[model samples]
Every structure is written in C-alpha cells, then in structure tokens.
Target chain A: MKIELDNLTVSYQRHPAVHHVSGRFMAGEATAIFGPNGAGKSTLLKTIMGLCAPDSGRVRLEGVERQAIAYLPQQSEIDRSLPVAVLDLVSTGCWQRSSWFRRVDRAGMDAAWQALETVGLADFAHRPVSALSVGQFQRVLFARILTQNAQLILLDEPFNAVDARTTEDLLELVPRWRSEGRTVIAVLHNEEHVKQYFPQTLLLAREVIAWGNSAEVLTDDNLHRAVDTAAHWLERAPVCHVDGSAA
Target chain B: MTLALYDLVVSPFVEFGFMRRALIACLALALSSGPIGLFLVMRRMSLMGDAMSHAVLPGAAAGFMVAGLSLPAMSLGGFVAGVTVAVLAGLATRFTSLKEDASFAAFYLLSLSMGVLMVSRSGNNVDLMHLLFGSVLAVDDAALMLVAGVCSVTLVTLALIYRPLLLESLDPVFLRSVGSRGGLWHTVFLLLVVLNLVAGFQALGTLMAVGLMMLPAITARLWAANVGAMLAVACGVAFASGAGGLLLSYHLELPSGPSIILLAGLVYLVSLVVAPVGGALPRYIRARHRQL
Candidate 1:
C-alpha cells in the first residue's frame, strides 16, 4: 500500500511537534525517517498509524484498509512487569481476526510459535516477558508484529539499545518483508544504517528538509539544515498563511 | 481438645445462622476481590484502592441518612461517589498539571472529611462505627443478597473483559494499534473496581474493605510467579483468613471485621518470611548457595 502525507501538522501541548509537511511512501519499499533528536520523526510515523491526530491535513493510505497497517512502538513503551508470557503476547497479534470474544485456538497458537521460531525465540515462548533481555524482548516484539501479517509496518526506533548481532538479525526481516510486497517505515537515528539498508529516506526537522532517494536526501548539508531548524523551531514564530501551508 | 475444637471452630458456624451468613458473605468477597486485587497490584494502583475505599464513605453516609441503613441505597450511593472521585481525579491528571496520585490524594482527603461531617450531623456514634468498621456478623439477608449479586456480576464482567484488560494493562499502545479501544476497557475496569468496593463496604466497612482486596494479593505475590498461580493463591489465602477470623470472633468475642483483616495481615506477614519463591528465607538461602 502507498501512504501519502499531505501538509500534516501535529501539535503537543499547543506547540507543533510535527509541522506542516508533505511526503509520500511508495508501496512495497523500505523507507527510513532520519533526523536529529526532537525532529518529530516518531510523531510523523505516529500520525501515519493514526495513533496521533493531525492538527491539520491528513494521512492517506491507498489500496489498503487501516487495519492492514501494524505499529511497533519503542520497546520502552511496553510494560514488562506484566505477567504475560512471550507466547501469549505474540498471540495477541491475531486479535483483529479472533477479537476478544474468541479464544486463540490451536492454529493461532501454532502461528505464534512459528513467529517465535522465526525470531529465534521459540525457547523463550513460555517465559515471562519481564525475564527477557532487552534484545530478546525486542525480538519478541518483532515476532508479534510478524504475526500481525500486516501489509504496512510502522516501527519507532526498533534498533535502539539492541546489540549488533540482534540488529543484524532483525534488519534481515525488513527486506524479507519488502520482497513479500509489504511496506516498512521506520524511525531510525543512525545515518550510516539508513544509507546501507533503506533506498528511500525522509529527512525531517519538525518539517520536511528533503524527501526522496536516500543518497540525495542524506547529504551533509541537508543533515546540518535539519539540526539547525530543529534547534530553533521553538523560537521561530508561526508563519501564518491563508493557504494552510507554512511558508 | 476435640470438644474445645468443636466449641471454638465448628459450633459458631454450625449453630448460629448469622455466623454462617457472615462466612458466606466473606467467601463471596474473597472469590471476587482476589482477582480484582491482583489486577490492582499488577497495575501498581495499590494506593488507588485505598483512596477509592475512603472516597466511598460519604456516599454510604448519605445513603444511610436518607434511607436508614438500606443495602441498595448505601451501595448505590457508594458506587456513585467512588466513581465520581475516580473520574474527577482521572480528568485532573489528564487535563491539568496535577499528577494522578496527587489528585487521588486530594480528592480522597476531601471525601474523608466530608463523610465524617455528614455522618456526625445526621447519624449516631453507632451508625458511624458501623460505617467505619462493618458489622459482618450482623449481615442481614438483604445485605447477603447484594454481596452475592455484586460478586456474580464482578466475576462475569471480569471474565468477559479479561483479554482486552490484560492487553490494555500490559501494552496499552499495542492494544490501541491493534484497533482495540483501551479507553473503553479502562472505564469498564474502573467500573468493576467501584462495584466490588460498593459490595465490600457493606461487609468490611470503608476503612477495612480494601484489606480484603489487597492483603490476599500481597500474600500471593510472595509465593506465586505467574498470574494464574497468583490469583489461585490469593483466593485460597482470602478464604482461609475469612474462616479463621470468624472462628476467632466467635470464640474470643472479638470484632469480626477486624478479626478477618488482622488474620489476612498475619498471613501476609508470614508469607513474607516463609513463601517459596520470593520469601526472605528462600532469598537468603539462594544468596548463600550462590556464594558457595
């Protein structure tokens, strides 16, 4: 499915976290959103997932239902203290099909186990989520998202705090998903990482600096401009425009 | 000793109908409160239970003043009051700069004072005492019926929402992403809490009602690692304390409500020292083994 953001703006506590921006994510491609800290990379991704409302404009997903889009928030957002087992947590990915009224049957359980096997976490299936290492927990999250069988995946900093081996293991899944004709959009920090894996990049600093081919958009000048724009965003007054587009 | 045992433990319940009624009422509370309290503990809202208990007082007082110790009246009033405080505090945290804990504390304090004043103005010391520390042994048929009905509804509602509630409590963001309404589940869970509290206050009183809810969960945490195991252990502990407290009240001429809570407290204290998983002794032994 293709996603188009048309002049999207999201504000938190009356200050625009994601300013008026326009971009497009092509179908069946892996795209990375890279920016400096507080550049609203995650906010834009959230807006696409409909987790956050836009103060203006809208996100348009074509050729797919909203339910076909899956989201994987940062690992820190999970409450690990819950007594849920890894297997149970993963099985919840089938929630859209079974819903709360129907119990997860043998087939669903088998799929959950399969997802765990794919993530190399089959042995940890029955273990409490709290007992897993940070990397292992992230893998469990990936396993859950895999079971979602979604056409589009939105991830927020999936590699943060993850070890190199684990990161490599998880990175392999992105291409495998793209090969299967699924779109993956992720909020990533490492410029080198983005340059290596993602063909498309959206460079943002509370607004779009550049959006297109990774190599062209990730130039040093664009990165420097992104950082400068993000740093002084609060001091700049709103550029009021009758056309509903920021100058 | 056998005769003494019969006199101490068996005779009170076997011979007296009110004692049996009290035991039955407690058993119902235990069955429902154990699971409810487990969720509260897991959510780290232990103190919220305490605040909700205190907030129910003025409502119960108002009910008594208007209807004169009627079960339905007091329970309805208490449910409304508890839910109002919870909603108001929740709104305060969401809309204002105040934190949830601070808002709950502020609302409950105000509720406590209002309850005391309202009760003092309209009712006698006996009535106030009954609201503070319940008359479990004097549980009438109407009160018994109310408790049973609430327990049934609580158990059924909890079972129906168990999956969404678990997902919401553990991974709310994930729950939302999956198209589940976390807000609806949250409201349903809070309503369950209010229901259980309204039922419990009729028997355990406002001050000690949360004791039945919290003590069993605390004791269970020491011994049980999984959620299923924790709920089972908590229910077992709750029933044992209820039965033992009633027997003690019958033999030693003690207050039934205090007796039950104290027994539950004792079970919690003992579990802290001797429980198999997280107990002090087991932890000490594990540390020693690691050193070796």
Candidate 2:
C-alpha cells in the first residue's frame, strides 16, 4: 500500500509535535524514520496509524482498511507483569477474525503457532512472555505483527535495548517481508544502524531535515548538524553517529 | 462442634432471603470482575476503573432523587454517568496525547468533586457517606436483581470482547494491525466497567466497589501462574471475602458492605505478604532458606 502524508500536522494542544510535513512511503520498501530525541519521529508514525489524527492535514493510507495497519511500539510500552504465554500473545493477532469470547479455533491456533515459528520462538510457545529477554520479547511482539499479516508495518524503536545478534535477527525479517511486498517503516535512534539496514530514510529534528537513501541524506553536514553543539536543550554534544561506538 | 462448618455456612442462606440474594449477587460480581480486573491491572489502568466508579456518583444521586432510592433508576443514572466519563476520558486522552492516567485523574477528581458539591446542596449529607462506603446489608431483592442483570450483561460483553481487550492491553499495536481500532476497544471496555460499577455500587458502594475490583485480582496475581488461574483465584478470594465478612458482621452486628470491603483489602494485604511464590513472604522464605 502507498501512504502519502499530505502536509500532515499533529500537535499536543497548541504545540505541534509533527509540523506540516509531507512524505511518501512506497509499497514493498523499507523506510526509516530517524531523528534526535525530541524530533517527532514516533509522532509521525502514530499519526499515520490513526492513533493520533492530524490537526490540519491528511494522512492518506491509499490501500488498506484504517485498522489493517500493523504497528510494533517501543518494547518499553509493554507491561512486564502480564501473565500471557508467547503462544497466547501471538493468538491475539486472530482477534478481529474471531468472535469476542470464542475460543481460539484450530485455524487460529495454527496461525499463532506459525507466527511463533517465524519469530523462532515456536519451541518456547508455552513459556510466559514475561520471562523473555529483551530481544526475545521484541521478537514475540514481532510475532504478533506477523500474525496480523498487515500490508504496512509501523515499528517505533523496535531495536531499543536489543543486543547486536538479536538486532540482526530482527532486521533479517525486513528483507523477507520486502520479498512478500510489504512496507516496513521503523523509528531508529542510532543513525549508523539506520544506514546499515534501511534502504530509504527520513531525518528529522522536529521537522524533515532530509529524506532519501541513507548514504545520501547521512552526509557530514546532516551528521554534524545532528550533533551540532549549539545552544541546546538535550544531552551534551550529540555524539558522532558515524560509528556504533560514538553513536 | 456438633454442626459442621458447611451447616453453619448454610444457616444464612436458609435463614434470610436478603443474605442469600446478597451472596449470590456478590459472587456474580466477583466472577464478572475477575478477568476484567486482571486486564486492567496488566494495562496499568486500575486507576481508570477507580475513576469510572467514582464518576457514577452524579447519575446515582440524580436517580435516587427521582426514584426515591430505587435500584433501576439509580443504576440507569449511574450507567449513563459512568459510560459518559469513560467515553469522554478516552477521547480526551487519545486526542491530546495527554497521558491516559492524567485524563482519568482529571475526570474522576472532577466528577467526585461535582458529586460531593451536588450532594451537599441537596441536604443529603448523611446519605452521601453510604454512596461512598455502600450498605451491603441494604442490598434487598431489587438491588440483587440489578446486580444479576448487570453481571450477566457485563460478563457476556467482556467474554465476547475478551480477545481484543486482552490483545490491546498486552499489545495494542498488534491489535491495531489485526483490524482493531484502539479507541473502539477502549470505549467498549470502559463501558463494561461503567455497567459493572453501576450494578455493583448498590451493594459494594462506589469507594469500595473499585477497591474490591482491584484487590482480589491483584491478590490473585501474587498467587496464580497464568491468566486462567489468576481469574479463578480472584473470584475465589472475592467470594471468600464476601462470605467471611457477612458471617463476621452478622456475629458482630456491624456493617456488611464495609466489612466485606475491608476483608477484601485484608485478603489483598495477606496475598501481598504471603503468596507461596509471587509474594513478599515467598521471597523472604527463599532468602532465609539460602542463609540457613
């Protein structure tokens, strides 16, 4: 599905979190929404998912039901005390297809199992998700997304707190999804990580700084500006995002 | 000693019609709230339940004013108020990205204050306490009927939407992808909560109502290993609190509703301290065992 944000604007009361930004996310591609801490990256994706409606503009999700969008929020948003097993979590994907109180049918169960397998957690189906490592939990969430079989995937900081090996494991799912002609958009904090994985990127500092291929938009000017030691409000001198160590 | 505990328990059921009705309705409310409470706690929306409970005050007061303290009128009024707050709160939070808790806190406090102000103006000061604390002993046939009706409807609604509610609570993003609108599910669950409190407040009272809703479920979390078991334990504990509180209050000539709520709180405290694995006592035991 093609998503075009025609001068999208969303705000918290009067303060605009996402300004009049326009962009296009083509189908069958990976797009990274990258930015500094308060750059409205997540806000843009949230507006796209209809979680937050635009204040002054429109988000045209050209070819899907408003609810057909799949999103994986930051892992921190999940409740740690939840008692659901990995299998049970995956079964939530079949919810729209089933009646409210009905039991998971054979097909639904199969779908849950299939999702778990894709996330490589089929063997741990019965394990409580609360028992998972950070990476494992993220995958379990991805399993939820996969089971949704959504046309567009909106991921907000999926790689946060995940180790390198797990990051690779998760990133590998993108290409496979791309092969199936699905759209994947991720919010990345690490600039180098975005260059390493995503083919297309949108850079933001509460506005669209640059948008294009990672190598092209990730020039030293943009990189330096991202780290510009101007009279600023955040952590001291944003680190050189050229390498993982400084990033 | 001559009479078994079973016979003793049956004495109330056989002796008093009102007690039997209260017991039955209490049990039903307990069952209805267990699963919903679990999800609320998981979503960190327990306070939302509390807010919804308190939000019913104005509607209840209006109903009682019109119908002379009757069941249907009060519940209908409270249901309207409750659903309104739920819907309004949902809209306020999502539209503004103001934290859900912040919105809930705002609505509940405002409604609570509004309720109190109105009650004061109407010269119903003494009766207002009962609104806050409840009068379980006063739950007669009519109130019991209301409770039963509410329980059936709320439980059925909850069971039907169980999958989406649980999914959203645990993983809202995933629910959205599977054709679930976050606002829609939120509004539905909030409505169920409104109905539960409306039906239950006559017996449990608003203050005690949300407390009872949260206490048993939270206690159960410290005992049960999974969602199914948590619900089972929550209902069991709620029933135990009702039965024990009733027996103790009858023996002591105290208020049944407050006694039951206090007992629920006691159960929560005990579970917090003593569940075998998940509670503080269990952790202490393991530490002691290691030291020994």
Candidate 3:
C-alpha cells in the first residue's frame, strides 16, 4: 500500500517535532527514515499510524485501512516484564480478525505458532516474556507482526539493542515483506544497513533534509546537515506561522 | 475435638442470621474484589485501590448525611465520589504536569480530609467510627443485596472486557496500533475498580476496604505464575481470609473489619516468605543452589 504525508507538522506542547514536510511512500517500497536523535523520525511514523495527532497537515493511506498497517514501536515502549507467554503475545495480532470479544480460533492459534516458528521461538512459545533476552523479545515482537499480516509495516528502531546475528535475521524479513508486496517503513540508525537494504530513504531533521534514493540521501553533505540541524534545535523556538515553508 | 471445631468454626454462622449475612457479604466482596485486585497489582496500581477507598469516604459521608446508615444512599454516594476522584485524577494526569500516582494521592487525601471534616463537624465520633470501620455484623439485607449486585456486575463486566483489559495492561501501544481504543478499556477498568471499592466499603469500611482488595492480590502475586492463576489464588486468599477473620472475630470479640484485614495481612506476610514464585525462601534456595 502507498502512504502520503501532506505537509505534516507534529508537535509536543506546541514545539514542532516534525516540521512541515510532505512526501509519498510508493507501494511495496522499503524505506528507511534516518536522522539524528530527536529529529521526529518516530513521531512521523506515529502520526502515520494515527497514534499522534499532527499539529498541522495529515497522513493519508491511499490503498489501505488503518488496521491494514502494523506498527512495532521501540522496545522501550513495550513492558516485556509483563507475565505473558510468547505465544499469547503473538496471538494478540489476531485481534483484527477476532476484534474484542471473539475467541481466537484454531486457525489463528496455528498462525501464531507458525509465526513463532518463523521467528525461531517455537520452543519458547510458552515461556513468559520476562524470561526472554532483548533480542529474543524483539523476535517475539516480530513474530507478532508476522501474524498481523498487514499490508504496511512501520518499525521504530527495530534493532537498537539487538545483537549482530539477530539484527541480520530480522533484516532478512524486510526484503521478504517487500517481495510479498508490503510497504515497510523503518526508523534506522545504521547508515551501512540502510544503504545495503533500503532502496529509498527519508533523511529528516525535524524537516526533510533529503528524500529519494538511499545512496543519494545518505551523502556526506546531507548527513552533516542533519546532525547540525538537530544539534542547534532550539527548545523554546517560536511556533511556525509560515505557509508551506520549512520552519 | 470435632465438636470444638464445629463450635469454633461453623456454629456462629449457623446460629446468628447477622453472622450468616456477614459471611455472605464477605464471600461476595472476595468474589469480585479479588479479580479486580489482581488487575490492580498487575497494573502496578495496588496503592490506587487504597486511594480509591479513601476517595469513597466523602461520598459515603454525604449519603449518611442525607439518610442515616442507609445502604443504597451510601453506596451510590461512595460510587459517585470514587468515580469523580478517578476521573479528576485522570484528567489531571492527562492535562496537567502531575503524574497519575501523584494526582491520585492528592485527590484521595483531599477527599479523606473533606470526609473527616464533614463527619466530625456534624455527627459524633460514633457515626464517624461506623463510617470508617464498617460493622460486618450489622450488614443488613439491603447491604447484602448491594454487595451481591455489585459483585455480579463486576464479574460480568470483567468477563466482557477481559481480553481488551489484558491487552491494555500488557501492551497498550500494541493495542492502540491495532486500532482498538485502549483508553476506553482503561476507563472501564477504572470504573470497575471504583465500583468494587464502593461495594467493599459496605462491609470493610473505607479504612479497611482496600485491605481486602490489595493484601490478597499481593499475596497471590507471590504464588501464582500467570494472570489466570493469580486471579484464582487471589480469590481463594480473600475468601479464606474473610472466613478465618470472621471466625476469629466471632470468638474473640475483635472488630470484624480489622480482623479481616489483619488476616489478609498475615496471609500476605506468609506468602512473602514462603510462596514458591518470588518468595524469600525460594530465592534463598536458588542462591544456595547456584553456589553449589
């Protein structure tokens, strides 16, 4: 599915986190949102997922409903210490089909098991999430996303604390999802990983620094500009009144 | 020995109608409040139950002011007051700089002071004592009905919202991403908490109502491995405490509310040392085994 951000400006307490920026992610594309810390990368994804209301502008999905998108927020956002089994956590993805009240049927359970198998956590299905390591928990989360079967997937810093092997294992899923005609948007920190995997990249520092081919967007000049822009970000900056111009 | 056991345990409940009513009231409160308390512990809002119990005081006092010692009036007033505190605390957390626990603490303290002031200003210490420390032996038919009704509603509502509530507790962001309204379920959960606290206040009183809710749940958390097991254990603990406390009160002439809460506290303390899951003995054993 294709997604479009039209002049999106999201703010926290009237301070714009994502400034006026507009772009469209084409169908079945693998895109990485790369920027310095606090550059509104996660906020932009959240706005698209309808978790955050933008201060201005809007995010429009061209060919999918909101439920057709699955989001994996950063690991910090999830309470992994909760007393839930891996299989139970993954089975929640069937909520779209089961909604609120209906029990997850045999087929849904099978799907959850299949997702766990794919994520290599089949033996740990009954294990409580608190028993899993950071990487193992991330795999469990990805397994949940697999069960979601969404046309669009948004991942925020999916590999922050993951080890090398687990990172590579999860990295393999991005191309597979793209091949299966799904759009993947990830907020990434590693430039090498982005250049190697993602074909398109949006370099943002609260506003668009670059958008297009990954190699082009990750240029030395653009990278420097993103860091500089983020470093000099004023905490008490005045609200933007400009019409369709970068703040 | 058997005859003494029967006289100590079953005779009081069989002999006195008020004792029977009190036992049933305890059973009803345990049935509903146990599961709610489990959720509170799981949500790390154990103290929230205490705050809500205090918040119910002003409303119950108001009800008592309107109609002295009436079940319906007091319960309605308590429910309204508890919900208002919950909502006001929620709004303060959402809109203001105050965090949820801090806001809850502030609101509940204010409610407690207001309730105390109102009760002491108009009525004598006897009325205030009755409002604060409920008389389980005085649980009349109307009080019994109210407690039972609240229990029924709490159980049914909890069953209906069980899935969403679980998801909301464990992974709210995921629940929200899937397009479900986690906030709505959270509000509903809070409402159930207030309702259960209001029901509990009828027998345990405002001071000790949360004791029945939290102690059993905390004890259960130490013993149970999962949510289902925790809920079952909590209910069992609550009922056992209620029954044991009632029997103890019947024989010793102690206050029923304090007796019940003290029994639950004893259970919690015992569980803290002996429960297999995260108890002190288990951890110590594990450490010794590791050294070996």
Q: Give fnat of each prediction, in order.
A: 0.66, 0.68, 0.66
Best by lDDT: 3
Q: Using lDDT as the measure, name the better of candidate 1 and candidate 2.
A: 1
Give the TM-score (vs. native) of candidate 3. Answer: 0.97
- Return whichever of 2 and 3 wins on DockQ: 3
Residues A122-195, model 3: lDDT tens digits: 99999999999989999999999999998999999999889999999999999999999899999999988999
DockQ of 3: 0.71
lDDT of each: 0.87, 0.78, 0.90
| Pairs that collide, model 2 | A100-B160, A101-B160
What is the overall TM-score of model 1 with all chains considered together? 0.96
TM-score of each model, in listed order: 0.96, 0.82, 0.97
What lDDT score goes with residue B13 in model 2?
Answer: 75
lDDT of 1 by residue, B84-186 (tens): 8989888888789998889999998998899999999998999999988887898999999998998899889989998888888888888887777888887
Instruction: Give the candidates in order of DockQ, highest first.
Output: 3, 1, 2
True-structure lDDT of candidate 1: 0.87
